[model samples]
Target: MAEISQVSLGDAIYDRVCQDLVEGKLRPNEKVTIRGLAERLGTSSTPVRDAVQRLLRDEALIQRSMRDVRVPVLTEAQYLEIASIRRELEGFAAGRAAEMVGPKEVRRLKKIVERNEAAAVAGRWPQAVKYNQEFHFALVEAAEMPILLAILSGLWLRMGPLIAGYYAREQLGLVRHHQAIIAACENRDPAAAAAEMRADIDDAKEGIIRYIQSFTIDE
Candidate 1:
């Protein structure tokens, strides 16, 4: 029982760190020390070390030297690659969701979308990011494809920080793509849903890529 409790605690630490990463509390290329994390989390170093090791293994954090661990700063090529893959996989998931979604699920997703828009419009970027993730996951979950959902989760875990950073700097637009996706799902149009999902991803991809490129030019 004691051992189980310790494992659970370690897992909890891991989850908290992951959530921080997803929320952009931990930025790309930011240094992370086990001791620092342990102190910040108010826990022993053991679990914090274990959690850092897990994130390292997952490629969410990269080991720079013998002692330096930092969040990964994705190159433009890498970001574009991931975005292309997401366009295909996530688009497919949206299509499947459109076919399977019921009125109740549609209502739930609509509420999430509305909340996300409201948060974005109000300049509550963190809340908007949270709602955006919720909206995407809700749609994917409706597809009832566990394998696809798992893949999407992994992708989001890697991309979430970047998305949060992008949205934090930019003002919220209409998010017409999201509304289009919802409408397509309501109409039971799988192709239209998939196309809208792809467009949404493409738009974000272009914006983030441009931002990164400009930063590079400035440097």
Candidate 2:
């Protein structure tokens, strides 16, 4: 019983840590320690260590040394590759979600969108990023495509930190793609949803690739 409980705790910790990564709560290249995680989570070091190992395997956290780990910082080339993949996969998810969306799902997503818009308007970049992530994940989950969701989660694990770091304040005043997606879903229009989702990804990608090239890419 005790062994089972320990394993459950480790799994829980792993999921919690993954959520932080996927939601951009942990910034790019931020160092983290098992001891710090254990203390923050109010648990012992053992489970935190176990969870850290799994995250290391996932490449979400780079192993700096035997005692040091930090969130991985993606290169420009890597970011572009992932952005292309996200456009295809996430667009499909939105299309399927449109086919399945009901009043309840629409309400939930609208609430997340509202929070994201509010945060962006308030210049709370980190909070806005998290809510943006929440809205995307919720839309995907509504698609009922577990395999696609898993793949997207893995991609987001690597990409989230970069996004969190790169959300420009200037872009907040631009037209939001989420509102178009919601309109498509409310009408159960798969084609429109797919187009809107792809547009959203492309919109972010154009700015993000520029940001990466200007700041991080080598000539």
Candidate 3:
């Protein structure tokens, strides 16, 4: 089990909403209610409002006027745009971390990757997604660039659901992709790290597109 620190009320709300999005409990373009969110999170309306505001700023949620909100619909173009930004930002983060990643950090990342692999094999999709997120975040944090990390955080929020959906269908390939990233970091090869990161992001985009399209004909 990974050490997931308890977050503030707002962050807790945000993560729970994000998890719902990933699990398809909150579908694309579905309207969200503050009261509903508060009840679901077992928190008050204030933190739920704060969380929704933050997600709106991230463009993960659409805010209509002062009272209404909806899940941002995932369009092909929008998905591509977000995927491109993530590739550029995260690839840069991985490359930079390669420059500064020490033995301790590498060891931690390896452990996360290993745990993530095990989780995936055991069909624990949520745990796999959680570990995968921690692994990437650990690398980005190791870069030691607060501004860059902050920027990447927004991009990652948008990427979360697509990633979760992708892994819900495909597991072994995703696990292998993480292994490639771990290998690049272990070898301290920044260029390889960036290339692998981009490839992984691109693959994820394709997988998500395919997954959505498979269901579109029925809709």
* Candidate whose TM-score is highest: 1
The sequence of per-residue lDDT tens digits that candidate 2 reaches over residues 28-125 is 76789989999999999999999999999988998877876988777778888998999999999999999998999999999888888888888887
**In order, what is each prediction's RMSD in angstroms?**
2.4, 2.8, 5.9
Model 3 misplaced regions, further than 4 Å: 1-31, 63-70, 214-219
Model 2 regions more than 4 Å off: 168-175, 210-219
Weakest lDDT window of 10 consecutive positions for candidate 1: 210-219
TM-scores of all candidate predictions against the true structure: 0.90, 0.89, 0.78
TM-score for predicted model 1 compared with the true structure: 0.90
lDDT scores of the candidates, listed in order = 0.84, 0.85, 0.74
* Top candidate when judged by lDDT against the true structure: 2
Worst 10 residues of 2 by lDDT: 210-219
Report how far off residue 192 is in candidate 2 (Å): 1.8
Clashing pairs in 3: none
Scanning candidate 3 in windows of ten residues, the lowest lDDT window is 1-10
